[model samples]
Target: MPVNLADQLKQQALAQGFAVAGVASTSAGGRMPLRTAALERWLAAGYQADMAWMNNPKRLAVQQLLPGVRSLLAVGLNYYVDQQQGVGVARIARYGWGRDYHRLIEQRLKRLGRWLELQQPDSRWRVCVDTAPLLDKAWAEEAGIGWIGKNGNLISQSHGSWLLLGHLLTTCELTPDAPAIPLCGSCNDCLPACPTGAIAEPFVVDSRRCIAFHSIENRDDTLPLPLHGWVAGCDLCQEVCPWNKHHAKASTDPELQPRNWILQSKPQELKEWDDNQWDEALRSSALRRIKPQMWRRNLGCL
Candidate 1:
């Protein structure tokens, strides 16, 4: 398809509720320049902590996601909001404050894929959200959706760093987008804002110090004594970005809104609940990734 046609598809994505969208040629996939080398160095320093999955060599390269994939269609959804979690209440990552993004983005991608198939019935394509073993953040930057920030998150022009990314890859040829230019030329706010100094350097995050890793991926019973205060994903870096000043809080998706109880519950209140109660409370939220015991452990931090 022509480059104009690809741009048209991106317009359609915005109309369909995506906050940011772009396209990249998968045939060109490889380890992203500085970040790739940085990832290796971080892993070598034991910076990834115990999240061994992140160091998988295949995931570090995009071509490994799908053979014969020629073009990547990247989409980003804004999840930034003005509502702050109450103090004394453990903060859940804003993304997980609502419904699971994996299911939501997947459903939308399938719809987009269906439409693409109708446009080119013979083309082969694959939809990916966070579930795939691909360097999605690099693809997002290459697609012009956003630039990777010092905190290692995609920071959008319109949405700051609070966005979710999804994409589709097709065997068909399409005009690829020039990568988004980095906007954080001289900013060091995010790097200093981190409580754990996770943003060890510009565009590089030491997962060993990342609160999100401690809250979600750390399957162990005890959180590192340093990160016990975080209950879910952390947004400290995103919150401190200057670009976010002009950003509006995203409107609530019916599915993404937190339940009344979760928004209102005190840390002590949550501690009293058992597994079944936790399950019921988090039925519609992504917090289920951490079991009730984990929630209790996190709550204990307060």
Candidate 2:
């Protein structure tokens, strides 16, 4: 029985545990031009902070990276957990609460890519997650999975901005979905929610002043700003967004649920952790990026 390639691929993606999936065009215009131009302006402004890798030329050349590639299949998984850290504890972002998303998302993408090869033996596909040289959020939105919120995260109509994004570039030329439209309209709740004025303006997050950026990426002798109890990543903007506050559903994915170690640990405990303790807590976790000295540095900031 013949079936629509795009629909079948999306079904396979959902069956692979993705909450939402859609296809997007890799052709000129239709959001790609505007998205890349905005990125150029952002880079010119030095908004990427110490993350110099944003200058990767491949990021804007997804269309040319893979020969004959004509579409992207964007997928997102909801990672929201209702649990909140207690006072004096490390305020890790919900995205970093469980295991490493890179591994889990990569596994899912690989499985999807395998299914694609089975469908079309001659097809070529590229699986990408966090480290890929692509403007993932833009591609996700263009795929209709969600809209990019004023807070700089993809906001799904069903799952809000608490989504982990990944996508595949394929030569299959699947039918594209209508791009998601911005629905934040006049609502500025996420702006003032940022403690460090990181939301320099709507839709632009200056990483230099972002707590999550500083806590995870900055490695200077002393933190330049206040932490407000965050030792890993901050969640204030998402926590205050109306879409997340009112519409976000708690994810049931076991891999994304809050871990007991994170639930029980405090800042002081993290500061006092031995080498073995640190490794145990962060093993195979995205939080592993916060090395032992980084933990001490972050705790000292508080």
Candidate 3:
């Protein structure tokens, strides 16, 4: 029997450490318009904060991102780590506790893209991570990898909201998976759990008030007085979600494991580290993006 290319591709993705994978049609015949409208409203309300790239035209449609695209191959990597930060240590989100996901996931995606090209030599492809202007969570939900939860994170039945998403846009036609239905019915736990009130409403996050946004993306020397203690990204919303409490598990992948310092260092000790010491400590870790100065600033706030 001839092999189904889509199935083979999905198998390859799973072997490459992606916990979940699915394909979605790029024909623009489904919920994309609704997503676009929601995004437009969010941007209009200044919910994206200083992330102006969210307004890029390519984000609205797959065709704009990769011409001749026929299918979207979405994959999820679970980065949940079962560990606790030491007392008086700055809290970092679970996602950033390990190596930078972009670097690790992109390598897997590149391999997948190459394998697809070998199977269909003439097909064009584009691999995208978080840096791209693509609406990855929406595409991931559409592809059936997971559903978007009330906290705006992709929540898998098996992985909860601890997924880091990536996707490939290709010209090769593939079988589209069924879209995932919203599974966060009546679960408003995340909204009230957010310390900064970032989740203004179900499925709507105002980045201006997001701790992750202010800690990681805000370039200002001083963050809001209320947002402190989070040295990197924030996970309070996901931590409070019932799905995570039951479904989230520690990732077995060594590449996603947290660094020793991230899990056990005291904030006061980190604050005393000079530039050279900070660089050595973080090295290739995702928290390196916060910068030495920002690190001190965040620690000072704590």
Give TM per candidate: 0.92, 0.97, 0.97
Q: Candidate 3 lDDT, tens digit per residue, 68-178?
A: 999989999999877778887778888887888999989999999999999999998999999998989889988998998889999999889889999999999998899
Inter-residue clash pairs, candidate 3: none
* lDDT per residue as tens, model 1, 1-302: 55476877788788777888898876534336655776678789888788777788877666676677788899987776556667667677778877788888888888777777787787778888886867788889988888887778888888887788999887777788888998988888888888888877787788777888877777777766565456777777877888776664575566666656655677778889988898887775667788888777777765
Clashing residue pairs for model 2: none
Q: Per-residue lDDT of 115-167 in model 2, one digit per residue for the tens?
A: 99898898999998979888999999999999998999999998889889999
For candidate 1, list the clashing residue pairs, or say none. 150-203
Ordering by TM-score: 2, 3, 1
- Once fitted onto the true fold, the runs of candidate 1 whose alpha carbons sit more than 4 angstroms away are 1-3, 29-33
* Each model's Cα RMSD: 2.1, 1.3, 1.4
Candidate-wise lDDT, in order: 0.77, 0.89, 0.88
Clashes of each: 1, 0, 0
RMSD of 3: 1.4
- Model 2 misplaced regions, further than 4 Å: 1-3
Worst 10 residues of 3 by lDDT: 223-232
